[model samples]
Target: MRFSLRSCLASLLLAAGCSAHALAPRSPGDLCGFTEGRTVLLGNLVFMMAGKTTIQDGHNEAYVKQLYWVDLNTTFNVEGAIPPNVLHSTDIPSSAPYESGGAFFAAGNTVFIYAGLMGNSRYDWMWSYNAKDGTWSRAQVDGGKLNVDHRFAGLSAVAPESNLSFFTGGWDKPITGTVVFNATDAADTKWTNVTRVEGDDAVGSPRIANGGMDYLRLGKQGVLVAFGGYDISKNGTNQTETDHDLRPMDKINVFDIDSSTWYEIEATGEIPEARSAFCTAVSAAPDDSSFQVHMYGGRSRFRENATSYDDLYILTVPSFRWIRAPTTGLIPWTEDGVGRDSHKCVSWKDGEMVVFGGTPRKDDKVQKGCSRNYPPIRVLDTSKLQWQKQFERTTKYTVPRIVSDIVGGDETGKATLKEPEGGWANSKLQSIFSQTVARRPDITEVPIPPEPTDPPKSTIPGEEPNSSNTGAIAGGVVGGVLGVAIIAGIIFFLRRRNKKKNDNSFAAATPAAPPAPPSMYPDQQQIPMDSKDDAYMQLPGELHGQTAVPPRYELDSPIQSRNRTVFELDSSARER
Candidate 1:
């Protein structure tokens, strides 16, 4: 067998092909109906805000302002008893729908839903949902009128220790500033417009909306990092112009809460393309020493031909480094034509990230078509960079009654509901909302095995015997053939010499030849006077008219002997 470079490369490619399939994304099934809603992670539950309820509705689809949740600690069979773990509330207030441009964040035991479009009008009302009481309350803002230009504003909790929540940069009329809301004291909240300082040259603050923003504390200083959103600042008209078009901003904006200074940082290393309406979350790095901002799918642009990404990326804090996350599993939409944008994602326990409902980017011809089918809820393990499809429900449940219908009164008013036919304790809805925390065993990091090393090279000469043995075998065969040819040539030469000697003896015993006839020209036969005596000797009659030349002989040369042996071998081979 012969080894070749091409053969080696081909083998490597074949191995790589097998590896790629092993790393391919996968899905268990659809979790629920597609939604373009907000999501928050609390304990083991992922609470989804308002979203669409169908899979294939065109432009006429309606949004569901209801609250739904899935418990991560328990894996329920989709066909089994409607898992009490996965359920929704039919009693949500109608004024707050978790609509597009709305912001939701969790602080301590309570979740806050801030400024977003309720119906056609944008509202700055801040609503809070108490997890302990399972009730919602509206907060009153004292700083003038609550800024209503907060659609798609970037919102983040000021710090884990503080009750302050910060809202920055939004549109319909994009606000170029930051607003702070104190959950402890609603009257203490205020908004600060980002102002340009004289003689200070830096990248200007971004006027963006629908971008992902989060707060991180670096060395006791709180920093707000915002990335990828729609920017309408370049439009020549005012923010109210209906003809203004939105474009994705590629630069990342960071604000220092302590210094009140802003700096724009250019990201490097597999930076994601400009996108908006994407979901983002903060997770611990693989080393668990620092944190990284993990961002998932979003719309690439705001055009009719805009495409949604199913990729993932993470930006390391402090260093401001961008790393494209290595992901393996059934990627959403590759097999189902369902991509995600304007969705919500949250960091789960054990370095896991959960992605919930979002606007399903479909292939329909309608502009921004929303799929009626619910996209599967995907959980990604950051340590392993692997995605698992946990829940997917095929059968769409009946749309639950709204608060108004349940109360049999006006939609604007709060409704108190009597327990259904069964007592409150026996109702499945009660079990769903009961304040039970689903907890799982802590997931410890698995140690990775070290790669193997090649065996040491042989030190002794010819210790690798395969090649040496092949060479020896070839040399021995050639020497044997040469020895045989030499032996055969000696035998033939001796036999021929003996026959010649016998013929010579016989010729000497035979009769002598007759004298030559008299020359026709006797004068021409006389020897020349200038010739030597030996040259004038008589010649045989057969050689009288011919000139004789001496024969050349090659003698006693090893090269000649070797050449003779090879020639004889070749001749013998031909005859055989």
Candidate 2:
């Protein structure tokens, strides 16, 4: 038994009152924002809620439900709110954030979170937040009647104007039914299941997990643009996550919002190293003529080691080309290069991507040269194609040079790339991507109303988000008086894995629906430890950077595993 600081830290996560899912709390400021959480855009303000984070230390790191918001403009800062009645895990508090995949949509003044796994722990599996009062409460899904079974790591799209959101696919086989939630009448909002036959993998062809997708307005039709994820069937015979397929980002999957069909589109460019469990954010040219998706840090596990990436890539629509965006603000944590994964990305104020909490791979390497380290919360300004150390905090958005070059830029922005070489040749595909909306000065119309879909469920309709009365806004790391002070003494122990032999069995979490019998937590499979008496749970990931190929399988560390999270170690082998 290699019991030392490494395992000791892992043991601390379940420190009596903290609950089994709690990871060790790193000293403050080691990282920023939330990782593996859900994000929604409501106006210029982007709200980042849940996942894993190290806040002001008053609440449990695992169960404390903390909500953080970025104003996008006016200030380079992030403020948070402890929504009343935040959830916790088993024998823990109630109402914790979805561990990984949950449908988070923002419509009207409310943010609706309809989660299947962890949410099962609460009577109200679907929770809603009123941005108006900075309060969190329960929302209904057709009188709490969820027609479809519990699903996680699925695909989703939200249409604000129509007050409808679509979700399909689950962690197991690709789900045929499309789950529709109409928020037209908030109180009476209902869930409609557009059922499909199983075995028709093409039903939501490539409905893989841990990938990225966003709603787009091509021509005049609304489409869901998706990229990168892994299929369970792809897991090799080894049965161990030690090896698996890392989906390529260059390949694009298109889901037509109106038609309920899936299309595969071709792209030409340098293929980014295949990966899964990564984070993504998309922005469109002001005209809706072209769209660009920024793929940020994610992991790739093979052999005995786990690898996460720190670079960024841009996938543009129509031309359908892959362009690696320049990334250099945050310090490179390992030889693999600032490896990060299981984080969230939000397209912010005029074409910038704001990233929140990401755990870099734990490797002891100086990266060869001198570099400045930025906080866990990062921002990328596409207009200039460079990473910004802080938020731009301005309302105006300049078209990305890459987008303008392919679609056609303005006066000084000369278009250089030739027309796309036969990517959208199919009629059905052409009709979709070529679809366009008329923009007349008299009527403020966008190619795709940047409001609901493209800019996404993020743009709230009124008032600059005032956090003064909300949670404390950290400075520098995020911004504010307690910013540097809050995280001064903490170190992080970010991830954990089971050491039990033959732990190779893929433990799938059995998720239940609400009417409550447990605490809030998504589906996580359970497994046995080496010592029968000292059992710990196995999730879909690895320790020390979450390098597991599968979704970080939900691991409710009943023992030592939960302790290996959040803190960075100065010495000792970060036990696998």
Candidate 3:
């Protein structure tokens, strides 16, 4: 091994008490490096957990079990400004290995990742990432009595108001086992396996995997609308047996958090085709009249042919209609048609949806000239119903036109057509929505709100009239939120750098030897990437008795790996 002069100089600077961060070449805001996985957006910051990122190229990849965040405050998924920043963590991999395909949720200022594949094995444990201090720790799930083994391809969504997170419908489990956790008070947070909470039967589905779920708050009722995924082949015992069938987009389930019950409803309009291993983002009406769930890029595993998708579907609540949104813009999607799966989508502010991390389906041929080398984020303006290249700081949220036609809103997405007297759906389930949702026409909310202050501007390469060039520099652009934030953004960046230099609390994780690298690219759907991966996870019964700690891996090149493996949970050290 040889040390370059640059490395020697960096070492010397460190010895002379120079800041390692200051010596390292980085962007002005100290933007983070990008990694794909289930990412969480708390306001303007996007947090990413364990997933696969190309260390060198597409073929040379490593499984990451670390926490990374990117500042979207000053960026709108633009090319130059936003990048992943290492939030600095205690060892998170040594205790919880394997990466991605788990159920990730955010409540309060914490991010919770549950049941990701660890090594070849999996765990049913719940891991939380603290936003204040970048660190990872596991919660004592169900007071350590619940004995569900580690599983992947699951779905999770958090209701921040209630401080509750729920997980359900992964592999093997046919939509059973709904684990709920309340992190309102992190120090003594509680986890409840809704399946075993009482003797009652939990919500059931056809062994769904890689589905899309997002929360919509209506008054006191917080509902998670989950739909579309692979329906694994199951037996009488509800155990996943063989391959799978793509679940129909029409087969939707609405989990009402307040009632702890699920309502099965079919949506109308131009419905989307059946698909799975997809992601979802939700933008709701301020008055809770409706929620537009933007479902994007997913794949379907049929018999022989594995197909990928790049279309957008908006599912509107109350009206319960599925509007197959158009993808006619110059850049309709980020990855072309290369089968987006296991990715994550979060609503940015009230206007756009930001997508991150996802591996293309194995059979889908590689993209034309593009890869993850560029920005790994995709922004979609759900209201405008168009894909965009960059985010604009809009003063308000807009409802999509077709959605407003049914649900009715006062804003830009306001209904163009008058809603019928009885509303969209029939009487069968009308009570559910009527009781929970604010109806149109007579509904006290705004009838037709004002349009955006300016004609909404985007930066797509070949976008039409209102669009501008993607090459437009971030600093030069004015109006909306950034209209006069040059000095403020600058001040924020300086304060961030200053804090990093003075803060000694983040000095805990310094490793002597790097961990090993994970070579296999595990599918979130848990399809046998290889026979070894399949066999290693085939051990029958639930993991009982003592908790099994997963073996951690490092990058094949330690230079890129997160050296630390253990992180102290903010609350307790007991790993239950």
Candidate 4:
């Protein structure tokens, strides 16, 4: 029999509906680059540097470029200039090439930009910026000492709350006292100068660039964690005690922020090799251990050649000792990692430390100021203690760069395409399509329920019959059947809607690599430390402590065991 036009149209509609429900959902990677199991959050890293100066002549004075900011995901997020023209001075004097910008601090919502110099010269001007606003303006400490030198000299701040910015080693000229300032109270700027040791002789002459003023906390209690510094001449000489100055204080110094007491840690394990100008950062806490202040890359005269180390040492603040980190597999040059120096490092809460862009091999190549080998950022997990390659790029960077100031927010992303990345952007079309699809829910065909049967009395017309039992029973059965079919149809439609919703969501997530465990030195516990008497169980007080054993990856590992992969930095080194 020939089909009618209405019948043909209905058949075509039914065929089309079947095709729509047959498709499967897209993979999560297609939606987002980060892996489904991982989360990306905002972290802060800052570094310290002297700014460039516009000199009148070749021999003119160098100006200090104070602060610069970076976004971890974007790399170099908020960077430009800090106020001071000189290394030590708060006042931007007319004679000054730039503002005597001293030091900087980042606490909770605000970043404190303090002004000062190396001497007693203090500038009252201060500035602060709300990380949310991304804007900056002048700020001040309520009753703060505006001393520029004390403000800018060797300084460090505590963790968790970047609020308490402290200044440790600086000049007292006639040998007044070593000052520690409190900038925690937004309204108070009182200068509390306490002598770590009495007199100039006992103070051992102020140490500056030797080891920048650093702080490590114990059980969250605030204390100044002191390490290596220029213990001798401004010319990088050994001054104080020939032994103490020469050995670079294998001794770790601890100063109480509240009390004016000084304690030196002496351990039985391996101590960190003495060096200065090295970088340091808090390590991601894998267990209940307090923060590990990881130090990397610095200059040293111990080696016959002008040496900058590619080693890592950790300060276990609670026990108050420095322990040589195990370097067997990860430190010197693992197949999966880069051997580097003068690079900046910062602790990322998600379980890794991100270190970026440092000059390798400070030999004649670096001494001649050769611009080469700025590798992509490398991340090391605190638990695993192994470096995982992440990001790389070739861009010109300013000097005296610090990692602590760089900020990564939740909105940030690390996308690796063969194109220049965006600071706060994505392909517009992708975003539009994603949002449109996400808002639309899929529609499914629902079956219609059968209509109930009418009572036979209807045929009797005005007879008013069928008020009887048999007729009522038949009507009830028909009603129940129709009701069951309607409910079943509704349920099927709801399930279909849910499946479509999940499909759309799958397209919106990011795809990232698999997560790794915290790093451990490959060689096991071979490193030295004062186990029994040490303040910290692992770290040693003096030069004697167990060294960290390096980590050795197995043949089944991803990069090393499988293939001979070659990683080339701006420097010249190749794997066979």
lDDT of 4 by residue, 1-576 (tens): 113333443443334333322221111101000000000111232333333222111111123322333333222210111111111112222322122324455454444554433345555445554443344556654444544543322434443332455544422232234444454554554445565564221223244433544554332234565666444334323232122232354555555444445554443234666665455666422222233567776655442443456777765434334556653323433223233443445555424555544443433133211111222234565444555443211121111101111111111211111111222123321221121101112112111112124311111001112235556645654565454445434444554575655332211122222332211222223322211111111110111111112222111111211223221111111112
Q: Write the per-residue lDDT of candidate 2 for residues 1-576, one digit (tens) a residue.
A: 333433443333223213211222222112232455566665434665545543322222232234445443233322121111121111111453434446677665666765544423423246676554355667756634553224465666666445567766546342455666777776677766655433222344555566777766564546777777655436644422533354566667776656666666667776787676677777766656566777887766544555667777887776777887775543333244456676667776336777766544434121210011323566677677666644654434566655565557642333334235664455666666666533222211111111112211111111222346234322221342132222221222111243334322111111221221111232333332222121112211111122112222111111122323221110100112
- Write one digit per residue (lDDT tens) for candidate 1, span 133-227: 46678755555444452354344443433444676665545455566655544334333445553223344555665677876544224567787
TM-score of candidate 1 versus the correct structure, residues matched by position: 0.53
Error of 3 at 49 (Å): 1.6
Off by over 4 Å in 3: 1-36, 55-59, 80-93, 119-126, 136-138, 147-149, 196-206, 233-242, 328-339, 360-363, 366-375, 393-395, 406-431, 435-576
lDDT of 3 by residue, 144-169 (tens): 43324345566777665566777777
| Model 4: per-residue Cα lDDT at residue 525 | 31
Candidate 3, after superposition: displacement of residue 219 in Å?
A: 6.1
Candidate 2 versus truth, CA RMSD in Å, comes to 20.6
* lDDT score, candidate 3, position 124: 42
- Candidate 4 or 1, higher TM-score: 1
